[model samples]
Target: DVKVTQSSRYLVKRTGEKVFLECVQDMDHENMFWYRQDPGLGLRLIYFSYDVKMKEKGDIPEGYSVSREKKERFSLILESASTNQTSMYLCASSLRDGGYTFGSGTRLTVV
Candidate 1:
């Protein structure tokens, strides 16, 4: 199976603290993505990388950034966590098809 592993299943952060969410895939997929899933808002893309050292801003990149230093790893950095940022973060990877292999997800809450 194309497996994507996330560093945390749940997280809590203060309003102004920095946060990091890690994701790793064993399939060596060329594409990796980070998204935040909110109720009624659906999935909002944060960042994506198609190749090493190559990154692209997705639909919603504000207050967030990503790193893709290797083929199997991707990281999401929250410059400053806020209450509005509280949501379910998901990591995904894909090769050619549009279908993405998703991580179990990380639910983050900012107080």
Candidate 2:
């Protein structure tokens, strides 16, 4: 069975600190994404990778970066986390047929 797992379910960080969010997939999905979920703004794409060592900037990539050194793992990095960056981060893997499997999500709070 395919499974997506996130390293953290909840986190708290201070302003201006660097943050790392990790995600892993049991299935070797070619497409993966980092999405931020806000109450009113909905889901915003932060970064995505279609293949290992290949990453593309998403809609809101200003303060974030992504790494996919291995096909089964994707990492999201915050250059300098700010209060505005605090939110729920979701990691997702997509199958060729467009089916998506998402992790439980990591909720980050910046103070």
Instruction: For each candidate in the order shown, give its overall lDDT on alpha carbons.
Output: 0.95, 0.95
Candidate 2: stretches off by over 4 Å: none
TM-score of each: 0.96, 0.96
Model 2, range 1-111, lDDT digits (tens) per residue?
679999999999999999999999999899999999999998999999999999999998998988899999999999899999989999999977888999999999999
lDDT of 1 by residue, 27-97 (tens): 97999999999999999999999999999999999999888889999999999998999999999999977
Off by over 4 Å in 1: none
Per candidate, the number of residue pairs that clash is 0, 0
Model 2 lowest lDDT segment of ten? 93-102
